[model samples]
Target chain A: MRRGFPVWAVYALGFVPAVVAFGGGLAGTTGPDPIRALEQTLGLWALRFLLAALCVTPLRRFFGVNLLRYRRALGLLCFYYASLHLLAFIGLDHSFDWAEITREILKRPYAFIGMACLLLLIPLAATSSNAMIKRLGAKNWTRLHRLVYPAALLAAAHFIFAVKSWPLEPLLYAGAAVALLAARLAPKRRPSLEQPHEA
Target chain B: MLIRVGTDLPIASSEITPRSLWLRRRDFLGAGAALGLGLTGVARAASPYSTDEKPNSRADITGYNNFYEFGTDKSDPAAKAGRLKTKPWTLRIDGLVDKPADYALEDFLKPFSTEERIYRMRCVEGWSMVIPWLGFPLAEAIKRAQPQASARYVAFETLVRPEEMPGQRSFPRIIPWPYREGLRLDEAMHPLTILATGLYGEPLPNQNGAPLRLVVPWKYGFKGIKSIVRMTLVAEQPKTSWNMIAPDEYGFFANVNPEVDHPRWSQATERRIGEGGLFAKRRPTLMFNGYESVASLYSGMDLRANF
Candidate 1:
């Protein structure tokens, strides 16, 4: 219904970053360590999409910018990027060695947390479609999607732990994730008697 | 060519630039171009100690680095290291040495002739590069200093310039600045150890430690401290930067042993630079990084425990 901000445009724009990230590596522009560049590019976009999706709720609550229609598209984009990140890790990084991948996911704290976040995202992504939403019912779908809150935290923690240093870059992302989560957790204003709901 | 191991083949005559002609050409290129070739001017020379395996491309060698003095990112060094000034450099030799005095880089380097030693440099982060470093053996300098009997270790320090090094100025410092590294007295005197002044037969690039850097081929690349300013002979083991930050993961020795893994990742293999695409299988890491000659340095000690 919101023609000012199109959900389809978000989907179209979301693919651009991924294309650029992969194209840079394929074209040898992603520096000497292209594996790291590509994986980081996909992973960062995943986290950014999650944060962008989180912003949709706040935008409507505070500024009365009812862009809630784009939330589903943003959430799906996050899932897609997260999936690609995982694929890069499992195949490109580890050479499709399932045993090594499993051992890493179990023993490495950062990898373990990152895998856990992806697992949580899977269910939400599976149920994002209208048919699955209808089958699961609105309340159940809403409850399932709330898993993103913890996933965001896990993603932030994974980013920090992977660096293994107190660098400013990872810390900045963690701070942004925490701030967005706090905004979502803030107590909601009671429906005002005088304030008419936007049609 | 393919990765040649355990072979020290002589370079073809075509590849070896006549030293006199090369020097004249370098003089003509001016100081800027003479420092390092811009991804195309890679120089090559044959040495008995040099491995036959191809050295990494100039771009990868310069662009991909772990010089945290510039910044933590691998590419940050190439981007920000241009600010470092290498002209009129001075190196101070002190702490338990007989002749403790400052020597200009030119005067200090005059005592010994530079050698072209193409060596494999392995980073603790699981990447590796075969770099051709040009410098004299570290023993030349250590012997010149005439260290006292009490001196059992060598401590090296990098210059601390907040104006030039943004990492030093960053709030919530990622590492304690004026980065430090050390080696045992014997390790410092080892023939494999050198004070690298240049790479690819060119003056060392700012990103790759301009004036002078240490090169211990048998150890992890971090142990080869960059942009050095001071060398101190000490009685006790000296504190190192990475060890100070994460003692559990980085040990004092920091030797390139594949058996002892880091806390977060395996060290059994490394991704060779300029090898292939992302999916290319990593080459298995070797003991002492294929410089098997250094194993005796830790003959009696347990590497796992030390690691």
Candidate 2:
């Protein structure tokens, strides 16, 4: 168990929120509004996993922690949570009412932004496999995965707009997204050639 | 705590239904009719109306609240309102009333008989619940005050104490302190308008507006101001807290209309509390929250324009 953690563990961990939410809902433990609680929980976990996936590179570069092996798994898990979040909105909130769903998409800015983020994640989730990486080539694969940054920002904005008031929780998530993106975009430091060599 | 069981209340034969039967069904049916009806007779006879929907669980009703003075979070009121000192509370009735007077909490509630009112509470945020509130009609109290002919509107105000209510001290101020709401004089005098004092057969929990509060079922939940401290009969429309903060988003006549959507969200559907799974299906919202009895009050008025 110490040598290298199984990727299946990450997959298993990802399903925990869904199970807990459903279980809590059925058992009457999700307070007065179980559906809203469930929807919010799923969406929050998706955002958290997306942020975790974003942190993988920054952690390795800044803190020298190598979690590269689990990066893809984390990304896939983020996509999985996002899919559930979308399904919860469409099936539970809207009850497959296409007309109402369309009207909501048109009226609610947050809903539109959330939908856009999910759409961007689809291609990344589809191409997460080793075979797809080989087919696309390393450079093209890296380029395609870059969509995650925008997706993360949009998800953060979606969270902020969803609430009635500007509470600290959504603001904190938005701050983290901004800081992570700044770190990713910052110029890489290089050793100066003009500096004298140490004896 | 007073546990008013279904079998212990007198109910009208016409009011008995599948839902009411389910509540009073098993025990009352098996027991003799005289014994069963006799017990529930007083409560049922006094209560003029009630909803068919099952009341939300006591925990849900008290645990989830929206007393903004305590805080903006739904759970904040439940967490913070325990510190509120409700025993020494007083209510002031003034303005266009001939007999303006201040009454202590006990004295304020002494004159009227309390009865259970099961109502559908729909929040502007698109969530809904059926609550069983125990209180006397607002008209009973208003009648004692003797409003003059000039009194066209009634204004309600909540208690304001920053130390007791932390949200009042919030920097940048989410809402102006001493939350206020108003209703047309006719609306305030309506039979459905009540000053709630208890829930689930117990004195109202602090979070759920202890001592006294208003329950205007036909309007959005916010219109039912909490922990009321003052009532004034006025000649003009009074400024309400939400309308003052965002006039466009919250109108004075904050009636529940599916067609009139909030600027940020749709009002067509609502997420019913304690129902469905994580993605609970949103049921279509009814006009005036299904209180068609009060429809005539808004006759000839454009709801969209007024909204």
Candidate 3:
């Protein structure tokens, strides 16, 4: 077996819990509080999958593990989970009441932030394909992908604000993300072989 | 022996006619439904929990809840409440009461026959539920306590141990310990309101305030404190849990009036729990939860401020 797992395998594994969670929610099989269980599961998976996608770059740089092949797969999984999260909210809570939904979007600050995050992810997901990346050019694609950083922050904020009274869990995730980004920015010693080749 | 033929309590007369009993049953069911027992299984005329009864249909069980003891989620109480320590519970009735006493759970509950009353429970968050509650009037319980003339208001306190309830650890310290609720003497003695010990028949589920809880059918659910540990009859209005947190948002008289909307959201409409899909239509909320007969009591007072 290879030291590294395949990207497709990782993606398949990620979807398993999410699909089961959604199915359980739809089937009303969640033990007692089915609605709450479904909501928490969808939201947790979306954030967890998004964090996994964020880790790909740092993992590659820090450990010299060139798992670039898995980045696209992880990114796709993030989109899938986020979409499922949105659908769960729409299907279970709103019950398709457009008027009520519009009211909630306007009234509740968390709903607006969540929708904003979802909107930002749509473009990123659409352009995740190799063909789209080739069309956009590598430099332009990198700049566009940077949007994920803010999207993650916004998603975390949505959770924090929605649960106005409790913020510990969400705060922990936000703090860790900030630390990860800080690690990315910290100056790194250049490799002797790369410096000689450049000179 | 005091004989209750149908609904009439004949203290001295023992010779009861079948026609009198039938008439009394008719008066009891018809008047009781109107007076708001909202009883179940009986016909619309003979029973209170009828399909077409607007007031009975509107009592919301979903929104009006303080599940903070179980977890932060709105639905947490229904699930996590099953684990609560409900047995061997006692309610200490003291302070300005002529008969300052502690009643055991069974003895406290034994005197009255539990009746199911459906009421709309509106939450500050903007949702509502129609719950079928099993209990007698709050007035009956308080009368048994025999409050002194000094008792102008009744204060209720919930259990506060962090070990028993996990949510206590999560709440902001600013929120007062042992969630409390209060009611004016008249409101406390309102015939429509109930001191609920059981719900949906049998004993109350823990999350639904097992053992004992108040059911103020007219007011919001938070006014109905669950897992009550103490009942103190006081002269002043007690500081309620939500009101102390945010005064403007939650008020003392948390009546279910759709007209006086919450600052964060509208109270004009509510989603009937377990009724619609994600796209289910929201039904229009009623004034005073359709308790027009009782609406006049608050006519002169500022409902928005009191809310």
Ranking by TM-score: 1, 2, 3
Q: Name the docking class for model 1.
A: medium
Question: What digit string (tens of lDDT, one per residue) describes model 1 on residues B107-220?
Answer: 777767777788999999888999978888899899999999999999999999989998788867988978999999999998889998777776788999887999998899
- Rank the candidate models, highest DockQ first: 1, 2, 3
Candidate 3 Cα errors over 4 Å, as ranges: A1-4, A31-40, A62-67, A88-92, A188-199, B1-66, B73-84, B125-128, B146-151, B169-176, B257-268, B276-281
lDDT of each: 0.85, 0.84, 0.70
Candidate 2 residue-wise lDDT, B1-307, digit = tens = 3322112335422244544453554356346455655645422432547886777777788899988788877889999999998877889999999999998777767667777788999999899999988888899999999999999999999999999998888754777778999999999999999999877656788998887899999999999999889999999999999899889889999999999999878999998887764557788999999998999999999999887
For model 1 the interface RMSD, in Å, equals: 1.2
Tens-digit lDDT track of model 3 for B268-296: 77755554323345577777777666776
Candidate 3 has an lDDT of 0.70
True lDDT of residue A65, candidate 2: 72
Best by DockQ: 1
Clashing pairs in 2: B8-B39, B8-B40, B9-B40, B9-B41, B10-B40, B10-B41
Candidate No. with top TM-score: 1
